[model samples]
Target chain A: MIGGRPDMVDDEHRLKMLMVAGLGGDEAAYRAVLGALARHLRGFFRRRLASRPADCEDLVQETLLAVHTRRHTFDRSQPLTPWVFAIARYKLVDWLRRHARQDALHDPVDEWRNDLAVEGGQEADTARHDVSELLGTLPAKQREPIRLVKLEGLSVVEAAERTGLSVSAVKVGIHRGLKKLAAQFRP
Target chain B: MRTDDLVALLARGAGTEPMAVPARVWAMAVAGGAVAAVALMALMLGVQADLAGKVSTLAWWGKAGFTLAVALPALALITRMARPGSHVGRLPVALAAPVAALWLAAAIQLAGAPPGERLALVLGKTWASCPVWVTVLSLPLLIAALAALRALAPTRLALSGAGAGLFAGAVGALVYTLHCPELDPAFVAVWYVLGIAIPTGLGAAVGPWILRW
Candidate 1:
């Protein structure tokens, strides 16, 4: 049922082509595949982690790293979606297991259902807090541009102007900030 | 970090990174493990004095064939499990086939033997030492295969470990055949199978911890 849809088939074909090319050392194709996968993985994690939306991006990054590092395991002849999603599913399960253990330690069994039922506004607030906390971990040079360009939706030029940095510096800040954020979840 | 940034970073290293080919990795593991196991068997137990004579016999071929049949399917199972979401379709059945065939042969052999000799046929001369030897010999292959699995991605950690163990154990038994003189079907059906099972159990038990990414 997964690849039965026409659009799904197109995605499968396109992604498989990109993945194959990527495996053959085509960096652009590799980047394109990862970019497309990021969109899909964001949706996948968001749906699964609805109760803890703050964790979706972390899980997405983790799965993306797993996919990138384990790309060699992918059979060139196979469809790309299942292989990619399988890693996603594994990361989801792994994340859930680790968090479940932590949740068990911090929260009583009686409050578990209530935690799951946290309302939308509260969830958004928590997500925002988590984003700021993540950004807070970066140095000012990286943090300010990431906040402005990524969180606050400023253009790179505007962020550079606001921070008194070159446009390239602002771009580098965002990139390095994002890289650091991804690395935080590595272990 | 934004997913886009992470993707960009990952792509930057793509062409420069050395990709591990699954087939090549596994082949090296199996080949290296087999060689190590054969050398270990030679050093520890020494080849049976009649190995040259035995190779031409049906019983020797049966033992080799049984171990091979099990090992091949187990290798297939582990290969399937190395990748996430890959089905191990019919492989379990294939792995079981040799044991079933051997057991059937053992039953027939027992039926034909005198009741007094039946126990001897089942126990053979080295019943206590056989399984133990097989398990010990499997260590190299188990370590090698698991190391290979570690380099790749295996989502079902325990199952993949068990597959590696099964493959290692069977290969171990195959190598053990170089030294084992007993050719009774029942003895192999029971003790050789036990030898393979030890590693399989060990693999399953340690899989979650060792195979963790």
Candidate 2:
């Protein structure tokens, strides 16, 4: 196991280094951060957009572009993640606005089908892994909120902002989604 | 996880990619600095005229030294506020005014202003007075110095403000020292104290509102 404080300090320093590099316009540093953040971005879009891969990719691109244009706005002293995610959240909202479909207003489901794919390999693992399958069984309305807020680690406020729902609406979606996921697991 | 493993993961997974700055931004930074310098010069002239009219009792050097002493506490305040982790946000900045005020008060007491004058007179005098012009001019020079720093402040208001304030105070004090008369504890306590206090107070109060993105 790694020691904690040093790791923390080191992480902080690396974060600073990334900010400095971005500020200084270093291409290598830019690519490094982009590569690292891509998974999170994809996950973010996946959870919020539900099944809309194209919309998610479009948002990811837009967010990246905003990051580029507003890079100078970043304070070298602040945390990089919060700032980036704040931008990402805003971009997601913008995306939702531009592409407002009749489907978006519906309740979010708790679809976790990808997690269930892991269960196909073995029966013993499958029983233990039923929770993932159950989560996948949730409706899209519930699944989307759960995936975005819980799996992707967005704050309720942020998830609401990005998904274009009221804070209470998002909370309820999570509550209902979780109830269904729990019931499915037991059943 | 091992330190190396965690490090690798972190390095691999940094916050986001670095964004390229356009040539225009750099040009804007330089242009902004130049403009601020010109405005500061005008303000400095006015300040000097105001100061000279108020403090006829003391020699030019005395007034200059007093101003420099008052400006010192700003250094600590500015440095602390400029760093990322600093909580020197709006409330904190507002809260900091009293400390600056206290420093100004201490400077005046230390400066030993002439017996006939009131403490408020020392601080309230315009920067445009005869010898006071020397100190007054420092404000513009301060503005110019800060203008250059603005390039670094696009999104980081508090840091930028702190950097600008600290820098202006330090440079202003240094210049004042060369031209200022010998230091008197009494002079430092009064004029110098107020000089720093007023600006810091203004900055603390106005910084948040003006700096928001």
> How high is the CA lDDT of each candidate model?
0.84, 0.47
lDDT per residue as tens, model 1, B1-213: 456665765676345334458989998999999999999999999999989999999999999999999999999999889987799899978987899999999999999999999999999999999999999999999999999998778999999999999999999999999999889998999999999999999998888889877
lDDT of 2 by residue, B97-129 (tens): 644654565466645656566444443433323
DockQ for all candidate structures vs. native: 0.27, 0.05
Q: Is the docking of candidate 2 incorrect, acceptable, medium or high quality?
A: incorrect
List iRMS (one decimal) for every candidate: 7.1, 14.0
TM-score of predicted structure 1: 0.82
Top TM-score prediction, candidate number: 1
Model 1 clashing residue pairs (backbone): none
Cα miss at B88, model 1 (Å)? 0.0
Worst 10 residues of 1 chain B by lDDT: B11-20
The candidates score, on chain A by TM-score, as follows 0.60, 0.46
